[model samples]
Target: MAGGVSNEEVGGKLWIMWSQGVLVSVVQSTNQFITVNMTVNNRCVCISFVYAKCLQMDRRELWNSLSSGIVDSQPWIVVGDFNVIRNDQERRGGRPRPFSAMEAFNKFIDTAGLSELRFEGNQFSWCNNQQGSARRWARLDRTLTSVECITMFPEAYMQYLPRTTSDHAPILIKLEAESVSYGYPAFKFHQTWVTHDSFLDCVANAWEDGIADHGMARLARKLKKLKQILQIWNREVFGNTGQNIQHLEDRLSRLEIKLQEGNNDEDEQDYLVAKSELDLWQDREEIRLQQQAKQTWLKK
Candidate 1:
């Protein structure tokens, strides 16, 4: 972690963590946010994690700090729970969000040259969790990146994972590069397949289809049948994971361009749907890579 809590009175703090291979150096830190330069594979990028104060007056300090401090040309990314929304559409079941608040937030993005990254999963990342009439939902958490950052990793996107114990859902920012293709080998079970909603159903169906034998031979036959079924399922459900991600990235880029020119509700909805689908596949990709690394480590 690169930052710490400065004030005991404040309810929230900011921190940034990375794996062993990545080099991280703190550039600046405050109660509101932590700025750092991260180097991976000899490429450096600046990232800031923010947890803004609930009050608009207090948040102005964070806005000013980001707008004035991050003046460099490096690929820059800003993410976290901002505690503010950019527009009316971002909130539901609450009193209409104040226009002044939205205006100020927009002003900061414009000043900083940051674009809200297209995202997948739930539309709202936070909720009051109240019942029907009293409930409130808002997109308080988000990922924003500079034009340079987008150019550097055009397939990058943000994913709002389903909320569990917390009122706020966890968000993931994926910075994807072009993938290298390796020829397919023997059948191997991917750990990520278990996370899919339909995986169990597919497994059960494949297992119960009725093999003729009654001993070790029967089990062997069933296993072979299941493998074949799983391979087909993987292709139909996920396709080529890397290629699918690239395709979605292209679609999102076109939608974003159309959105910037003007507001189109249809385009906005399509972008959200595509983002959600991309995130699902990206999550699977992350799990598969982690498992592969563990296997390689064990072999060595």
Candidate 2:
């Protein structure tokens, strides 16, 4: 909860709630941000409640302030309304966001060694309920934490709660008692992976690389070998599906901007190319979401 919830909680004098084994205390507070320090089971977790400004510079300043407060070797979690998105896919139907604007936020996350705590539920945490050109949905609210936090409470995960009256969704960060072991994520093929130019080549190479007796056993071995190849291909070529979409969107935005500045034929051509690629990725995103939701109505 970023906008209304923060206001209501602060107004109702219920900003901080403490309980046994968990001690919550305010470390810093400003109109745009609040830092809460909590100690549970002798492990200290720093949570920053942020409400960043709309302007790029203001958001960058907020990031700067946040990065400054992080202590080395301590568990930290930052949550709440960031107001700015790190990528184009985070928002839909609004004016494309510039790469430079997100640079500061990305840099801060990198420098602070923070990772996004991928949550379950809606992809977007906020929405402007307008149709056509005015419609916009964005993942403005996010939960991010230090690597140490993930290492300590491996089972901990964040969830984006449904939005009620407020434009923002309340994020629930759950920390389980047992520590989870780190392991490789299961191999699952994404439709988006096929959009790349080298996709067919990569798959063919993986298929041809396998050698075994001709039967079901050989098929199983080939599939197992293919999974490993795809995993490596994903890291080197695809990266994160959502992030790849964002990067393509960012490139499209730049080309569009350049075209708008003057009648540059090359810029226009590049814009079209990027736009086409973005469309393909977006379609894959829709398919991925439908598969995840497992709605009968959405099934092909």
Candidate 3:
């Protein structure tokens, strides 16, 4: 159920621990990773906990072992600190990552037939707690799964908890059944919407058309119209705040890579634009979270 390397090992060690509720049997254990077969709720799943080597050359072994060793039809989930990133967007404030490194990591994922699980909380899991420009952040820790694993855990998600002592934030993964939804939800206006320059124009346009009624009847019709228009406007302009931030971050990463290869005025401008847009979305997301917290507190 548990295994790890001693201090004498060159690279870091890995350990797999589980509760009595679940049955676990180690299939393979190495300095880089630990693979186990786990059964819970009468269902079996394969999991790998990895602590990859810092050196790219050394990590190649880890990649090769996992890709070849774990070839099976069982639901599989691989999780841990890979010590490498799949793309430029997974890092910030660090020296530009080598393209070859990213390509290799991505290739490993593709070859292994694994998909990175979507996560919540901080974008980066690891951070150098240095001051000013010395600070660096990267998403070295993550969860990946095979198609069968996704089918088995359709409502699964990972969350990066706030760090207390370590450079890396703790990652918590939840596997639960999907909840059924009923009825249309109420339309709640987000406070961030008012910050956009087109917000006023959008509202004005929605309200400009008059309903052929008076008093309460006219007010009710106008309110419904406004809500419908705002919903569409939100979709077109703002969209999903987190997803928009991610899009901008990815664009900025690509632009940064281009800029690193060779300085280009166009790419530089685009990077700045993407950064600006990303900042705006991040701020909006913060405000939205704050509002949600307040609402939750009020309900409690």
Candidate 4:
């Protein structure tokens, strides 16, 4: 164990621990975050435990420091109580979050190149143990990863385990994918995958490489070939669009932060361009989700 709340301590402390067999080293351990660098199979991965400050400025500082702590190319995963939420949906029965604060938090994630891991179970990770109007809930706890890490562990997922004797839910991240424990993989398409850069190209190429056949036989052959092509594309080219978008957004956020640090015209221009691209990509993702939701609704 790295650290924990002192018996007499009032506030929380960051703690981190790992199983044996992996080479682990402490990169840094502070009140806000703990960075643990681990190596397995000749690959390096950094895991961070974060307990962010509630104040806006302090939170920004945490993000800045945390972002700088890990290398850009290194596979990093951060899990903890951020004391912040990404969108309004993550919060309930609380005063509306300040737009500036939410934007800054999003920018921090974007700057840090962190993508939220899709979670199962509880959507809200924290709840204020209060009655009536005082009762509020927010997803204060979450797991985020760098794009490199997401690519490294594409099957990684978080399960919000039952909360007991604590306001925050205990989240369990399954690093080892379900596919490993279970045999026979089932193929299902994700709506977000279409937002990927090479999605259309991949589909087009797969469709182009078809054999000459007739009627139902030709359709069956093409569909089978397409499935194989898509599986390969999903594994290699597509990967995860959510992570890809997060990475791009992070790059944009970094550029914006640089603009704030200095009066650099080049950086300002870069930020604008990046922001435009991010918006476009976001629109595509929204459209994909909308289409998928419509299809699902129609089916029901």
Best by lDDT: 1
Which regions in candidate 4 have their CA more than 4 angstroms from the true location?
1-12, 178-300
Q: Give the backbone clash total of model 4.
A: 1
TM-score of each: 0.60, 0.53, 0.57, 0.55
Residue lDDT tens for model 4, 4-23 = 32211324475555554677
User: Which of the two, 2 or 3, has more lDDT?
Assistant: 3
Model 2 over residues 1-300: C-alpha lDDT tens digits?
Answer: 111223344432224445445667777666567788787778788888777778887787778788888888888888888887888877766588888987778888899899999687667778664433454677888988899889888988887754434667678889775568898766777766766899999889989884957899889899888888888898898567788786885675455334434456677568657767777667878887766656534673
User: In model 1, how large is the Cα lDDT of residue 182?
Assistant: 94
lDDT of 2 at 120: 71
Q: Residue by residue across 1-300, what tens digits does model 1's lDDT show?
A: 333323224444664667667788878777888888888899899988888998989888889988877757889999988999999888776688778988999999998899989988767788674533465678899999999999999999998765534678789888995588899888878998888899999999999998899999999999999999999999998778888877876676565445544557788689778878878777888999999889978997
Clashing pairs in 1: none
- Candidate 1 lDDT (Cα, whole model)? 0.81
- Model 3 per-residue lDDT at 6: 34
TM-score of 3: 0.57
Clashes of each: 0, 0, 0, 1
Q: If both were scored by TM-score, which would come out higher, candidate 1 or candidate 3?
A: 1
Give me the overall lDDT of model 2. Answer: 0.73
**lDDT of model 1 at residue 59?**
88
Report the error of model 1 at residue 271, Å. Answer: 25
